[model samples]
Target chain A: MAQEKTYIEDIERTLYDIKNVDKSKYKSQSGLTEDIIRDISARKNDPEWMLEFRLKSLEVYNQLSLPNWGPDLSELNMDEIVTYVQPDAKMTGSWDEVPEDIKDTFDRLGIPEAEQTSLAGVGAQYDSEVVYHSIQEDLVKQGVIYTDMETALHEHEEIVRDHFMKLVPPKDHKFAALHGAVWSGGSFVYVPEGVHVEIPLQSYFRLNAAGAGQFEHTLIIVEKNASLHFIEGCSAPKYNVTNLHAGCVELFVNDGARLRYSTIENWSRNMMNLNTKRAVVGKDGVIEWVSGSFGSHVSMLYPCSVLKGENAKCEFTGVTFASKGQNLDTGASVIHCAPHTSANISTRTISKAGGKATYRSAVKVTKNAPYAKCSVNCESLMLDDISRSDTLPTMDIEGDEADIGHEATIGRISDEAIFYLMSRGISEDEARSMIVRGFVEPIAKELPLEYAVEMNNLVNIELEGTMG
Target chain B: MNKEIFSEIPMRTWNWLGVNEATVDKDLLVESQKLDIDIEADHHEKMVVEYRKESYGIVNISIGENASLKLTQLQLMPEERNHANEVNIVLEKKARLQLVAVETGAKSFASKVNIILKGDKSQADVSVLYFGDGDRSLDMNYVLDFQGRKTVGNLEVYGGLMGESQKIFRGTLDFKQGSKQAKGYEKENVVVLSKGVRNRSVPIMLSGEDDVVGNHAVSSGKINEDKLHYLMSRGLSPAEARKLVLEAAFNPVLELIEDEVLRQEIDSYIKERLENE
Candidate 1:
């Protein structure tokens, strides 16, 4: 008898592929220009300083050149992409007040359900504006602030002006400069000093306009000795034309504070997900990152942590599954600037059906970082001969007291492991799925229960096939 | 004098990190010699070549079916100067090549080795030992490209950096498509003995065949305190114990030197550098 070859299908994106009518109240013209930036600023009632910042960022964006490395981006045409789209709705504190079509989109994504049971506060952004945002009154009374970025800029101008874009400057990269120039809606979170938020706050971004861009700026500051967990989720409906997501996330963990940031990115195949995220940890502070990348035509994201204070620490756990036309380049970066700082990064990537996955990272220990330690481990699983996986990591140490170690392995599932499982009555396909699940188990367990289930479903190993 | 890119990584990453490639100002056009060696079928051969007198050179070696070759190259410049060298090798079916490279001399040295397993069942094992002291700078790139089924490749690098020295090492294991059942491993260890030294490393593994196995590891740090204390407890001074620890790290590669005379010369050179600390 001839053995049958097992094949795993690509992520089932049916639920997220639900398209909405183009009911946007306003949409920027295709192509970037000074006039467009000025119009956006005027329409948003921009503060004088914000307008100056936007103009300066636009200048920087023009001066910068495209990255000469990583996944190909020649297909991303700024000349044809609409920089912003305002959904036909106003910001509301209640989901019932949101427009029916927009609410339906988030409702299908289970945002409402996740908000009720799993999240303490929830903010949902549709296109270029936050449509719904709400936080529990009890938490608000505890001096915790969770609201849209625009609201924070207006209500807490001093704090927002101080921390916004400080961690991820516009000159960090070309896309970052573009984001700074035309960014729209995201979340702002602040936990009071020494206060620990018991539950996680979440922000969901849905890009509904075709050939458009979503540039959100999320700023979070956990004050001294305070702790918080924040989750972000993003997705888009598949369109024939390309879409862009150049969102930026900046986090500040103050002295003795701790912050955990988690994200699940499931963009459509025609989307270019070029996102930037970073955190600055203070003395005795800790930062943890949990990430899942399941969809995107091309993605280049590396969340970074700057250990600026002595004894600061960071932990990163992430997984990327690339199938068919996907190329997901993701990893973590750490910079140790103070004595006794440490960081550990672990990631797993799976490639199938002509997909490609690359893990690229950098670890730098400055001369002042005596006794700093960093360890990086990455594993890649290729599902077939047509796929590709690569690991590229760099370590730059300026002092002998710093210790850095990196290990990477690339291979496929062992036939013996599959055979052993089959001998125990499991089917071949089931056995393979089981093995892949076990490979990503470490990263999955780091996520919230619902997000983990979502990730497993995206990976096509959930056994139930419920989320699609 | 001119500056050129050397020791480029297989797949370029973020250029801002400056590890994608190395640029050095040197006279690569210095009078260099070309040496070629060929081993016939079923034959075993061993040879030692030194670049101290030659200064700059290129070496190419090819092994026929079922042949085995053990080759050692030494780069111990007699005076302070700059040079760039290249080595290319190809192996046939069932052929094997063991290459040991010891580099310890030169004001600035750049070296690249490219090995391709072109036939089934071929294997390549490469060992590199380098020492960077004084104001010397070293840039090295080693790549093992697997093109044949069932091929095996292993790479190991050991080095120490002191003084104001700087070093960058890029090692890659590439498994091309149709190279089924190929296995490759690369390991690099750098011991920094002083505070002013700078060390950078990029260990990359690229795979296009699912059935192939690829692994790479890199580590950089100061001398092991426990081992140093143990040696000091055994009737050695602090400096002596430090030297011993570094010598132990380079011993495995040094022992691979087939020529006794050449091996001792390289060993003594390493000792002289360590003693200056």
Candidate 2:
């Protein structure tokens, strides 16, 4: 008897790799300078305070130094990156009004179809400006304001002023300062008090120009006794030159409110992703984060949550895959500042073909946070010997009344499990794929059905040709 | 009059995990020893080493092929002085080594241990127990390098902290290339008993061989509340319940000590420290 031959196929990313020609009506000159900042502000017609705010942020960006930890970002030169690029169209409420080229890009990515069937509202940003925006009439009648950040800045000035860049100040980090200095277009969602948005709102960002940077600032505020869910999707076409993403997300959950923020980022291989996201929860409020990172040449992202009120809670569920020619350093952070606060962090990572994946986290329980509890669990799988996976977790508890636990494990797939499956009339390659699917089942279950299927397909593509 | 200056400089300088370097007094008196011998089949060796003064010492030992050695080390310097120690060990083909270390008293203590498996089928096991209280600080760095085929190494550390004490632990397992069929495992558990006490632990595994396996796990937190409540309900006071918890945590490392007298001394020292707290 002879054994059957098997072949593994690589994952096809045709849907996301389709690039649109550069059709920008305006693009800022390459490099960071006072002139470029002034030009961006002037073009956007910023308010007096906003102009000053951008200048202050640029000052901070110049004064602050790059981080001494995590993956090195020396290859990312600001001198070669164009800070902002405006497409050849203005904002529109109807999809038919959008330019054909811009509409084709979103259509290929299935944004309009998703909005029509699932999302409550959709804001599509092409390059550095929102090209199209729409919301369900019922949601708008219920006083739920969902629009582009630029419009909200002028219409709802007071609310946007109070919450803009407040949670994650420019001085938080060097990239944060850079984001504040050059941020262009993102989504602004405000759920009214006691209103429940049954469907999730989504914002899609498409970086079309090469050698350019995308700096979008997303702000979401759920008022007292209200609940909302927001999803973010971002991707770019592969290019020889470097592209940068330095976005910021600020979420505010009022008393007894809840917010679930989910993201699926699939940047091109020539991208350097340095994003920041933070949230502050009020009394008895809850915040949940679901994230998936599948692209980028180098990435350093850590979303944080501050449990500021009594009985506040947070839960973070994430998964990251670092394939060939990629290095991703991502995780979560939680600060328990009040009594009875609790946090749970669970993450999984996969590395193969010389890629490196690191999970770094910090959980701090202050002295005043009596009876605070935290638990962190991280698991990593290395498909080949040449790959690397690391877990670095820190717990700083100031009192003896707190309870904290951390557990991490790193290894490869077991041969016995593969053999067991193979004996049941399954091919060896299929068995390996099944095992990998099982490994990420916990994270896939947390996603929506369509997204879960997409994640599984990604796993199948990554596992192809991995077995000898 | 002439003035003499003394500086606390760590012999090794590098970042551990994410923390900075830990400094130690460099002016202490030095003592060193080296041991190399071969043992025949069905033979064994045992030795006990102790440090009692403000001093620095280095001890190197190599076990012969098919031989075994059981070593015990104790650190009991004065409460006001700082001390540093280093140990290196090698195991030959078919050789085995077992080590137990007990750390009790020192204002500031630093120690480094390195073990190498140089021959085929070598094995090593290590156990450590320590207590930190008052203003005392303890730092430990342990590395296990596997260079032989089919080698195995295992390490476990247990300790407790109270008062304003601090401790940092760095453990590494390195499997050299060509050392096929090798395995390494390490675990560390620490219990915090008071506020303002800091505990930092970093466990690393560096593997260069495809057929080798390495793993490490660490956990630091307060004692279990349900266990404490159960003990208190069974006719024990709060202090007694705390003592029982600490005892249970350190019992795994203590039971491995071969010397009864030394174990008794360590137990009494821990009991006195807990009583004062």
Candidate 3:
């Protein structure tokens, strides 16, 4: 009898691991201070009211305390981290007009190709500022405004001022205040009334600087009877030192409108990702979230949705994979505040190689939300004994007419299933990988074609060398 | 006048979804009991313990090898009185123990039960039923620790809350390292029958062995409308239909009392409570 061979191919991260030389034309000093915030505001040419808002947010950030739950953040020091980094390039509306090195980076990341093929618009941000932004002529003709946040603030001041940071206020948490204090480049989108954009708009964020923090604020609004789909993706190169990403996303779906938001975050192992996102739906409106978390040293992300009007609906589908040296705490939150509202949340997590994954969530049905319906399902799979998985869910229902259900399960892969698959002429490694792929198929099927393929490949790469 | 030394002592202090801290009144009398029995082969005994006043009591029991014990506890305190009760039990090899507890009336009630399976092949089963109404408060905690190989433990609780009443239930199943092939399970079901009632349930499972199984589940909601409608269509009044539903929900625990008269008394008490509501 021959022993089974263990295929130990390292998961290839070359596409995201490509780092450029440190050619920042402007860089803020290490540490967070009032002076640093003022300097960032000055560099971005913020208006007087915006500067005041930033100063007030800094005060709030100073008064706030770190969270006591989830992963430890004592390893992150604000004194050693630079709050802002600007690459040696200006914002451009055309890819060909972008700087050579930054354009090459996005080219290698396939951002420009994706823009040409599948996207209705594209915004690429390198480090702290968006370098290239473009939208199709038809979308512009249809009264859709998709551009960088800075441009939107200057051109469409009223709308930008009305919706910025309204959903996720600075007082929401510590990281939210930090984001408000020193936020940088992100995308801003608006669709007019009764206009339905058939294609999806994308924003790609690449943090190329080490020991620096990226705070991007994204605001999207779909007006009454309108519909749109937005996609966001982020990645960073590996470094010995730690990096921070505390971005915020606020979405508004008006009466009878619909919006779908999809995100794929794969930060390097040395990054701490503490992002916040929320959406508020009006009467007869709908909002959907599709999320995938694959990399990060520590992450505490739970996107929230508030159904604020009658007949509003929300759906959330998410998946997280934690390998070695990772603690990913991810889930979703929903609040039903109106009559006849409904929400559904489904999540799956995979942990291996001494990693830890915790699924924490909260669902609240207020007294006014009569006839509200909510269901939450969470499942975690631990591939080895060394790994750990936990689920903690809370439900508070005050309406007698509300219907709520929650279910959670944690376990390891079944040996009997593996044996059965092996007996049917499938290799052990292939069988195990197939099981994992099947575990996340429900979430993967909700993704776009390119992302679904990427998720499948990621599962295969994570299960490469576990056969014994 | 009885001379009493006073000290503020907090009760029900632990981790995981915590309940409100309470202090024991120093002026109340404390009563305790200890029982150690070693029964012979084929020996079986049934016992009933009742608490009816403002008092504190602790009972300890040990079952001998190859013996069995069945215990029913009743907390039937007066409407103006409060009571605190604790029970600890241990089982020997091939021994079995079954416990059924019912809490009906009290201003404030607190109870804790701990069971340990110390010998190989030991087994324990526990069921609890509680009803709260009219500003009453209930706190209950149950822990099962498995120390012997091939040991088994199961716990189930059913509760109903109405009016302005409140209740908290904490159930934990712990499987130690040496408890190979052990199995533990816990389930809790709670129904809130009216507005302003609060019900909290925390079910925990802690395992240190690889070959053991541990599971817990909790379901809290109102009675199904379809079930109620089915009974109402069968010529029963609305109140009668509700009483029948409550009976069916608690029949599993009532059937385990083993005393027919006591079971009937509880059934009548439940009917009376429902009629008042």
Task: Give all candidates' CA lDDT scores.
Answer: 0.90, 0.83, 0.81
Lowest lDDT sum, 10 consecutive residues, model 2 chain A, at A2-11
In the range A111-159, model 3's lDDT, one tens digit per residue, is: 8988889999999999999888899999999999999998999999899
Global local distance difference test of model 1? 0.90
The best candidate in terms of lDDT: 1
Chain B TM-scores of the candidates? 0.96, 0.90, 0.89
Q: For candidate 2, report its TM-score.
A: 0.90
> Which is the winner by DockQ between candidate 1 and candidate 3?
1
Candidate 3 wrongly placed segments (more than 4 Å): A1-11, A422-427, A461-468, B1-128, B135-155, B166-186, B198-218
Candidate 2 lDDT by residue in tens digits, A279-332: 999999999999898888898888899999899999999998887888888899
After superposition, which runs of candidate 1 have C-alpha atoms over 4 Å from their true positions?
A1-5, A422-429, A459-468
The TM-score leader among the candidates is 1
Cα lDDT over the full model 3: 0.81
**Model 2's CAPRI class?**
acceptable
The deviation in Å at residue B163 for candidate 3 is 2.4
DockQ of each: 0.89, 0.32, 0.19
On residues B193-248, what C-alpha lDDT tens digit does candidate 2 reach at each position? Answer: 99877666656555545456666777777888899999999999988999989999
Candidate 2 local distance difference test against the native: 0.83
Q: Model 2: iRMSD?
A: 4.5
